[model samples]
Target: MTTAARQPIVNDDMHDIITHVNEGHVPELLHCVKAYTPVQDATHVQMTAVYEDGMELEVTAPAGLSRHFVAYAVPGPAHEAIRGTVGEAMKKLGVKPDSRVAHWCLTENRALTAHFRRLTVNLGEDERADWRPGYACRFDVPGHEHGRPYTLRRVSGTTAEVDVYCHDNTLGSQWAEGLQPGETVTARGDYQEVTPDFSAGPALLLGDETALPTIAALLEGWADEHPVRVLLEVGDAADQRYLDDVHLPAGAHVSWLPRTGGSGTALREVLDALETPPAAVWGALEVSAAKALRKHLRTEYPDADVRVTGYWRVNEKN
Candidate 1:
């Protein structure tokens, strides 16, 4: 037998594979190490080599350094077998591929308004969380690496709901377009509570379409109904119905502003002309608008609890 035929072929891409895993897919690599290996606190991991049967991993944890060989039961080329083996390992270990990722099936996907889609997903057996306003679900959609966040409007017994504005072709719109009954969706991490303490008293809540779910949620769960003045801006005039179902306090009022100009344009006028400042101000809108408004609130209404978040930027993809 010739010496050249003695060694097995690795498809001649071992170096590329190693670099990809070491740099690009480090998070998934760490997940596998923590889930399968004994080292739960692995701070860092590196793929040193890839072979036909398995790959060599160097792990750094609190207990010190150690080397591990992640073997593959399905015999194939190193590149082809890597993903399958890792998935199988996770399945065999009875764990998710990543702790932060949770799979949910869509039960309801329908239009809440002319430009909005309400998506209701079934919670997992282990998930029975208490209901709250402004809890958001960040979807791990395709094409968007970091994912996009949609505020949760309701979380009933075994199901959670979020309203998505689907006017544009961005990641949010993409998710809405593809949503259907029984379709699987990946929600990353836990529900982020974005609502400010409404117990502070009468307040002013302002936002664009993206903040409707949160604003509606806050109103729906009105703690004492002190009084709330809401100024909402929507891209489409037809979206005013988004808040029609929200029952408000007797002293509260909601103003639907036209999206004549850029984000925060319509709402900015209302903020500047406030004769008597409310006890608190909460807003979530475009970045430029949020920054200017946030600064204005702090400087003008120094005594009030001013909370403004730049939810999205101009021309934001996700």
Candidate 2:
């Protein structure tokens, strides 16, 4: 491989601090370096490295007491490269390929054995479902966030569908956009356990594009006697066409709000303009916006059962 000059992304102040601290234990730290890789998301790439033996270092300042930096080193040039390379290397070293990334507290170095043990234990108990199989049905829903899409899957029995929005701009949209038929993605918890009971009561469904598929599922499953109202925010008329093409239940009241500015802004406008129905309200959108609407519902209609979630954020990678 051709070696290019490695331009450090860290600033002068950061470099000085790292150098000053590393100088004291550079040889030992370098020896402990086991693997490294680059982690790439839609927005950015970050370097995550792991150290075998671990290192101890402290940071000092002119005005206050210094802080300590403790982490394992993964030996690679950049964050993305390190992530890829280290993932492969760890597998060869007999580390479980599905191990979660170690969390580094800014205090002291923790033992690798302990960290790996905890990770292994957690993986055993993790009940998250894989969504990669459903990626084939994923389709972009224009207007809310740039390059974002809605993912869909057919569930057995219950027409009631569940959609998850993780407002951080990382996996949800990226996965939706890149999803192909037969691809698989994992969800880290029991979805059925957390899904609220929607049977009985007037239903007001509010969500962005991400929630569209779920809303459709609910409508399909809902009894004709149940009065359901849907408030959806999309990117444009094209999105409306895509949604309209989906077969929804008969008599389901649907309203579309085109997101002209920010994702949350459109949601706020629609909520303010609409008449509050005496019913159970399911409001899901981007994380920050969902929080805002939940607050509004609490203050404006205290008696309503409001369910809100931040589906995704604009620029977040994960």
Question: Which number leads on lDDT?
Answer: 1
lDDT of each: 0.76, 0.44
Best by TM-score: 1
Candidate 1, lDDT over the whole model: 0.76
**Model 2, range 245-288, lDDT digits (tens) per residue?**
45676656788887877776776776666554535677667777
Which ten contiguous residues of candidate 1 have the minimum total lDDT? 3-12
Give the residue spans of candidate 1 off by over 4 A. 1-98, 316-318
- Model 2 gets an lDDT of 0.44
